[model samples]
Target: MAPFLTRLSGRAGFRLAAVSVTAMLALSSCGGSTSRSAPVLPDGADPHAPEVTEISALTFRAPIAAGIIQTSRGGADEEFGLNVTPQWIESSATAVSQIVAGDVQAAQSSYFGVIDAARQGIDVIIVSESYASNPGAASLESMPDSGITELKDLIGKKVAVVSLNSSHAVKIKDSLLDQGLDPAQVEFVELPYGQVPAALQQGTVDASSAQGATLAQVKDTLDTVTIFDYGDGKYNGMAESGWIMKKTFIEQNPNTVAAFQCALLKGTEQVKDEAVYAEILKTDLGFDDQAVASDIAPEFGATIRSEPLQLNADILKKIGSIDEDFDVASITLPTPDNCG
Candidate 1:
């Protein structure tokens, strides 16, 4: 019973219950074992002391827009009193691995990474949010000769995505389940994001599901079929991407975490403001005049329930095909009191 990412009432109980589980798991693990303890500041050391080194944050794309906030507003050194470096990864999978290895302090990851990480006991938390759905970015591009018009039309057709764990795959799965189609009836292939358009062109796959600037670029040439505009109606409540960090890091550096929140929330507010968005495009994002004029990014707001982010757990559970006995009510995390 998968619901579209649309508005659905009566889900608060489910979310709260899930949060309880997350909170328990997060807190209980603190006492279980410790191979390496969290870094501790020396006695008499100032907590607000300025940092001389950079903190590493992994990103999956070019360092622009929100990515700039990590470096320009205040590099890791200024924000964490420690230099914060932004490392770009080609895929979210690499970012997860880096975080697990303690190579990076934070990352902007796909929601799928969060779920997979939790399932693997990585002790991660969603600290902030970024983009959701952009109608222009969710194009369901198809081959010109595929004769595909709507999502339902591709009921049994082969669909291609970068990977089953990728956000594109989640969007494709959620979309198929929402349309009352048997997801297994359709075939899926693991094609890279850049090659999706070409795969569609060659009829290697019936369609390619991709989001963000990539979709915008290939929509016209691929004769993209508009399946569901996640942002068009109220379905935009879906969580497409957000900020995530290790639980141990958040506890050991509460102030740093707060500062991180302030900076990101500030960035969100700035991005929401039309004037600021313009400035970001012209200066921060470094987009050309023509591209900036056409691209419309999603607006952000400061709703920081970092510990327990507002997610569609029921929807996720359904799409993930989690068993009823999986007990989401016994498995979600809690929000911090300081989070707004």
Candidate 2:
């Protein structure tokens, strides 16, 4: 059984988008929403409008960028366009704010957030599965010499995470429960993603749950590795990110949606290629040139179980453990056809 978390945890407009025909058509299908702050595309592709050769979509965080789906380069850079905008928000909770406010077109988010959003009547569709490991990738890390190899060892430990409502915190809580440890056995301190390593160094927190940059930082700076994954042998519902969309948008634009699926699915395949992936991470995603050329690229790929893995119903059920009646599936948008 996956440990239950106590709690868990966008779009742009067209006109400014003049990169590729595919991008223009994608944006054109989006229509116009002047009332909101979200990005607005110019009204469809005017034959008069110049052709967009490529478009840049943002990556939610660094860890997501490390996976096979991101590293591979087989996807249509010309068809779906290229360039991914990377964000600073490290956890699912923060990503939701930007999505609802229309800061970006889509994001890598916790399935729980998508479910919760659906429950709240937000029309969201999970288009793809970004990561799937048996134990899940989220874990507690401590100094090897700290003698803290087990969850029980965290009884009096100070742990750090981005925020209480963030996915990382939820992962920690679930990990503790999986080990039969009271979640409250350790004190959890909230810290920014950038500061997790420093907190550990200063002994401000004995350990922190890391993902992406924080995970990389821990390994590079402290040589830390996982104490244990929260999900252990099960899905634990920690299935990383789900690419989501607004319900209203999907209902109105089937053709456009299908185009996106075909393109992204192709991208997912490309992400699996190590050589191509390395190039995407450093160049398209904008990792430091030195980091890519010298350091190892992050590991990433789409989950095989899902053509674009859908959320686990059991995990959705578990989310209700904290928020009674929270049903993320209630707001699920229609799944795109022939996504496989």
Candidate 3:
């Protein structure tokens, strides 16, 4: 509501310096052919002259990270002639900067981030769909005594969000509009997921939008009530985020993109198995018992669809996030046949 809030402070700093060191160590240990055995290739392929491609990817500490982690650990990447190394990133803004600077080739970004980037003349293509929200997967939360029992109660109240340009913010704003409430009446403050619970308890913000493990934490630790569910009503099964690459990078490295897509498809299928997903949460992401139990795994897929992305753009436009028209198809890559 604050002057068509697009860019919010405290959400764009780079955490790359520390992550780059770790990525370098991982690359050194994993890059040597002598340290690891020969990769298994498709039938009738030459192992001696394997056309392996190495790519560095940026990821967040969210449920979507599981697929890529499993892909690398499950040997899907190696099997597809790729050495995929993932670096944990702080935010989508940082990922965009890294991609443009050639520090990383690919990253997991929200649909809102992609649309906002396009409006700013930064060309990035969606290579694969990573996460779609399930019912009640994202929500607006407030303390029990906040007197905010319904959407209308939030008028003139401050709501904390990760970013004003985030998919969560757009969804919440759209929901407010659908309820016939003027979204500008409520103020959106930017806060990291880790600080949301504290901010709510300390009375810094009236309520906050939460998702994934953070949502699970607030429900467990605080006497909070969900004012609204972002996945409910007309927004059920909405595509939230996906893997993206610079348009020029995708054009120059078609085979690499295909391989990454194939491996991601295989990895997504693996996470659909409950046991496998739980293991990745406990072993890889370090989720506690409650966080793991309450985590609503997003609907993962590899194929990029135009409809959901177009819906996202429309919502952003309705909320006054972006003024220019965007063609969803222009930034989407065709799914590889093997991905199916």
**Whose lDDT is greatest here?**
3
What lDDT score is found at residue 67 in candidate 3? 82
- Write candidate 1's Cα lDDT for 185-281 as tens digits: 7787665555666777677888776554455555645546666554544346455666666776666665565555445554455556566565555
In order, candidate lDDTs are 0.53, 0.50, 0.72
Stronger candidate by lDDT (1 vs 2) = 1
> What lDDT would candidate 1 get against the real structure?
0.53
TM-score, every prediction: 0.70, 0.66, 0.83
Clash count per candidate: 17, 36, 1
In candidate 1, how many Å is residue 57 off?
Answer: 1.8
Show the lowest summed lDDT stretch of 10 residues, model 2: 1-10
Candidate 1 shows a clash count of 17
Model 3 misplaced regions, further than 4 Å: 1-52
Q: Which stretches of candidate 2 lie over 4 Å from their true place?
A: 1-58, 66-77, 80-88, 134-138, 163-167, 230-232, 236-238, 284-340
Candidate 1 or 3, higher TM-score? 3
lDDT of 3 by residue, 213-319 (tens): 88888888896899988777777767778888876676566667778888888877788888888887887777888788889887777667778767887787788
